[model samples]
Target: MNAFTRLRYRGSFMMRTLVSRSARLMRYCLLSLLGTLPLAVCAGEPVSPLLSPHQTIGTVNCASSTCHGSITPWEGSNVLQNEYTTWSRLDRHTRTYEVLNNAVSQRIVRNLGYKEPATEVKICLDCHAHNPTPARRGARFTQSEGIGCEGCHGPAADWIGEHAVKGITHSANIERGLYPTNQPIAQAKLCLSCHFGDESRFVTHRIMGAGHPRISFELKTFSALEPAHYRVDADYEQRKGSYDSVRLWAIGQALAARQQLDTLADPKRGHDGLMPELVLFDCYSCHHPMSDKRWTPRLGVGPGRMRLNDSNLLMLRAIVRAAYPDSSSAFDKAVRATHLAVSTGQTEGGAAPLQVVSKLSATIGAFLPRLEQQNFSPALQRKVLVALIDESAETSYADYAGAEQAYMAIVTVSNDLLSHGALKSTPALTDALARLLKTLRHDEQYDANVFRKQLSTLRSTVGVQERS
Candidate 1:
């Protein structure tokens, strides 16, 4: 029941069984969850199985030689029988548990006052291993496989066999215990749980201080880096609904902003007796010395203001402007109000930060289905690309956070355009993006001057105008 303790995996896991419908199983072979399940599942809406805690049946359950494991791929089949092989060998997630033993995680644990081994600490295990509650853990569950099958996909006890039953719908699978990673909003929330942190596993400033990696996430970028196992083909669209990178990026930014603000608003999340979680505030804003801190005045705010971590907010604005131009100004006002509240440390006023967060959350949530319905074809993609680039123009992206977001945004938009045939395969485009990407490779070492220069070069490659 440890959820990750190493299991003596069956030797038969490599048999070349010519399995039928294995293609669907391969497609289903996704590492898939959420603290905001209630937020995701409305009363009448279909509930995600992950909303309810389910017992983990372990990765070994699906690794039968005849099931997900095989030496090579099954030909002419939809399922790749070597899924387990791929995860265990090629996937870096398999090493999540082992990472805790590293000097860095150990030092973090020491700083966190955990006398026990980092592997056993709840803080470390929550994200590293599939650390489900004991009551929901089956006999097969162990803590050694890291984020094995059920880590993303919900506990499989109820869905294992029933999922294979004929006529069982994808929704039926979700109802049983499969986490619906296919849905854009749902996947955004689920991925953010660890990547951005949720109620159970939040990346607090304390953790960052204790040497956790700076959290940077964008849905399309991260998903591709995972090198997704399944293809987003016609069959995938039929099952998962639809796939849109631009839409995913937009929803992801909105959700991340919402999540960060929600965490900021939570009185319980405040630590070290700080009234508001200073963790919720921007790190570079306070961490840097006075000599290094030159503030930019924007949104009618005066100079010398210590800005909040509003990278996500800025991205969301561009996203909204691209999809619903009319609402962009209103959204901007709300965001500014919230930022002002945080900057001035004023909770009471017409622009109460929490109220602003709620309003924006609802507004962003309302925009999801509308975005989902729209097609992000070549023309739309081009517009979005420009809108996104415009958000980072001139000194607007002077901050490291904004610059980093813009860098990834540029890469994703340009890459997506290339894939969709919206962008011409020209050396100007490729080299510009590559140079911009290199500037972002190291946040600590990033030279803002170099970034600005490269960003200018990147903008010159396109029709994006410099906003005076």
Candidate 2:
């Protein structure tokens, strides 16, 4: 059957009843559950049933009155009365249509002369639709409700019907369809399912060519939607009681996602007729043409164009030093390249406008010979792994302008190390981590206010104690 018809059949009765009664049924069940539980149990406000497995996804399951479908706007809230309409019309998630249908996507397809921009069956539905139990998404199925709730979270069909009935326990929820967002591994699995496709799938042309934000997704920052879809508050005695698991899950997800992206982005393969070096550079990185056509590549992927203006490679070198002090040449070469990039960029007339990129290439060239000369020892490889984690934690890309490309480069290098299993087992890895944390602490502006809130989330998520 065609994709559209498949959706019609699968949607069936579940969609109409589930969506229509969503909010009221959820609140009713939540209130009842809270009433029974002791007051001392501080799980704050009833969780939106969307998080529960008992709620159907992609079946018009959000239409129930007083639930997401409530017609009378909830008190003073401006939330749309019908979540289905709101999600389809107002939510950015639905706008994937504009992205696929846009001129740019068309242009790329024309340039490549492919039959389509996104393969209707293989690439499109990977992230856009849902995956239900007892029925795997066929090779050709493409359900609408693009980027449906279940696309990010796991399938709910198994538990959506069973979770809310009186006496249905959380453990049972876990067994049926529930994916504990609080668990780092589970959260990572759910997210990487789309952002970084599983082993069964290959990165699609659309995902690879989409501009900036569209090209990549971050876990720590992007997962903020949880606050909207779930209960997250600082009012409690311990914030841990609320956001601990979700937050840690996000951090782990970020780390794992990066590793996955790096693994798939084999500069060695050189897909799309580009060199390994070119592949290593994110699409926006070198394509960015500012005044005088100084084509600087994008530091990070995606719409925000966030770049962390720090010596990322230098930091990676530091990680290498901490983990494998013997790899002094590799570490030093990275440091020298970073310093040269900065000094050259600051030259007269903005460092000769675009000559800095050439100088940067020269630095890499100088390092290649040395890098190639020495075989990576097990100890050295371990250091590279430690460096990856340390560098990732040390550097982040948040805002658009003034992002230090050096640190961004370090992020790429670190990701490469992690993907290669550099830190599989070694004492240097532990030392490098401690060193990275110490560096962040000592640096007055390391965890700036803007990042502190986010970092705090990571700390809680990882179950780590606050630094004294």
Could you say which candidate leads in lDDT? 1
* Residue 248 local lDDT, model 1: 72
Instruction: For candidate 1, write residues 295-383 as lDDT tens digits.
Output: 66665456676676777877877777776789888887777777667676464456566676667667767776676666667576677
lDDT of 1 at 169: 78
Q: What is the TM-score of each candidate against the true structure?
A: 0.84, 0.44
**The CA-based lDDT of model 1 is what?**
0.66
Q: Clash totals for all models, in order? A: 13, 32
lDDT of 2 at 297: 30
Residue-wise C-alpha lDDT for candidate 2, range 323-401, written one tens digit per residue: 4466656546534443344323334345542254344434433433333233344345334433433433533322211
Best by TM-score: 1
